[model samples]
Target: MGGWFRENILDAGKLPTLLALASFVLTFLITRTVTRLIRAGRGPFRNITPGGMHIHHVVPGVVLMVVGGFGAVGSGRYGVAASVCAVVFGIGAGLVLDEFALIVHIHDVYWSEEGRQSVEVVILATALASLVLSGFSPLGVDTLSPDEREDRVTVVATLVVNFLLVLITLAKGKLRMALIGVLVPFVAVFGAVRLARPGSLWARRFYRGRHRARARAALRSYRHDRRWDRPRRRLQDLIGGAPDRAD
Candidate 1:
């Protein structure tokens, strides 16, 4: 185990990344728990306000991110300083992304339905970080032989092809597939060849006059949402608390 850690994590220069990802996940989870408790009036936590202005956690998050990011860049990626900067950056990222919805809407909607976007973004970030920790390299180059990796032409070609495939997958409205495809090219390829989502750019452009294809896409989307929406919502609510009911 120690040998594997050294070879795959430390030697590969992934220790800092792993540390940051772990810290991000931990900080986000802790933040969510505390916020939920505060919302329920069951904890000592209270909102921060100064000079009649409500101060959101994202303020400190941005500060920490800037300091840690510059520190990491300046100090290099080995030893204690790098590790500390990575952790700080991770904590800042967690805090910022936890309120992604608020940032997007520029409002205090922490408990509203729109706030669920924050949960979704956090989940996506966690999944991506986990993939990285699991040794999946972005752009799917990790599977190449050392010799192929060393060849500039081969590497560039592979990256370009994979990038186009990812773009196609995104156009098809398969965001999750596209994201995973960055680490696993085959997934992106599959999404590229599949039917586009009914409302996706790909469908609007290519399947516009194709009634049958549009019908199939719509039906598939409806069935998929029916099958997964509730379960997905339940999972999000379990992790981040339920959205506040409309008054």
Candidate 2:
């Protein structure tokens, strides 16, 4: 185990990233737990409010992100100092992402239905990090032959093609698949080839004036939601507390 750790993580210079991913996940879980307790009035935890103005954790998180990001950049040496900076960045990211919905809406919607966006982003970030940890290189670079990698044009073309696929996947509204596709382009290709979700930008543009295509896309999306939405929401709720009903 130690040998694998040293060879794959330490020697490969991925120690800082590993530390960051660990810190990010741990900090998010801890933050959620604390917030849940506060919500339930079951612990000593309470929201931070000063002078009748609530100070969100994201404020400090932004500060830490700036400090850690610069520290990592300037350190230039991936040793103990670099690892510390990585942890700081991870903690800051967790805090900031926890309030992503509020940032987007410019209002406190932490417990509202819109709050699910935060959970979704965090999950996507975690999954993307995990894919990297698992040795998946972005843009299908790892799949190329050594000769192909040595060719500048081949590398650039591969990246461009994969990026286009990711963009199409995103347009189709398969955000999770689009994110994963950065690490594994095959997933993006699949999403791009599939029918777009109803009301997605792709469907809005391409399916316009094509009633059959629009109906098919809508039906497929409805079926998909029926099959997956509940369990997906349950999983999200399992990690982050369920969002409250709309007011």
Candidate 3:
């Protein structure tokens, strides 16, 4: 009996599982409360407000990174896997910038809007980076040998926990926007990269062609209704000794 228990549970060990559990619980509870608060304001908890939607959207992504990092270190994926997780996390931080921009645009709704948004995004991002680093590292399991199957408990738990974290963001209405917000920077940056390369020149040219066409249409309308024309017509009438300017 002892040997069977050791083979199943202790074979892969307990530290990784424990750490993942702790992270999952902490992030889940914290994010849920935050979402509830954002959806329902501070007064009597009865009032609904857009109090915390912005930061709540970002919390899950951060949780993933944290759990990934912890899995890397505890599972023994410390070499190249941890490094790759770090790089991806750096990219994720770049993604968070757009979210920050949105927060800036809607500052009137939040009290210390920028500060709160930044803190939440940064914390969640760090957690997610850690999880990725730990889970897929050499110690982790993104790559497995032909005959190998990882400890199913750890792998399954991680997937389930991350899914729940995401659901919290959606429990309110911001998940779709959060995903799009994260991807927007990636689209712009990758498109710019393609634009600079000669191989994708045709695609870039097509984009520019469309942009120029739109600009031309806008300019035509601007010239057709120039603001100066209105004032000039009034001045000309006054100089020509017509009726009063008011008329």
| Highest lDDT model number | 1
TM-scores across all candidates? 0.94, 0.97, 0.24
**Candidate 3 off by > 4 Å:** 1-10, 38-247
lDDT values of the candidates?
Answer: 0.91, 0.91, 0.41
- Writing each residue's lDDT as its tens digit, candidate 2 over 56-163 gives 988998998888889888775468899999899999999999999999999998988888889989998998998898799989899989999899999999999999
Q: Give the TM-score comparing model 1 with the true structure, all chains together.
A: 0.94
Q: Which digits, one per residue and each the tens of the lDDT, describe model 3 over residues 26-95?
A: 5434543543454455433332336754343344455545656554665452344544454343333333
Q: What lDDT does model 1 reach?
A: 0.91
- Candidate 2 yields a Cα-based lDDT of 0.91
Predictions ranked by lDDT, top down?
A: 1, 2, 3
- State in Å the error of residue 74, model 2: 2.2
For model 1 the local lDDT of residue 102 reads 97
Lowest summed-lDDT stretch of 10 residues in model 1?
43-52
Model 1 clash pairs are none
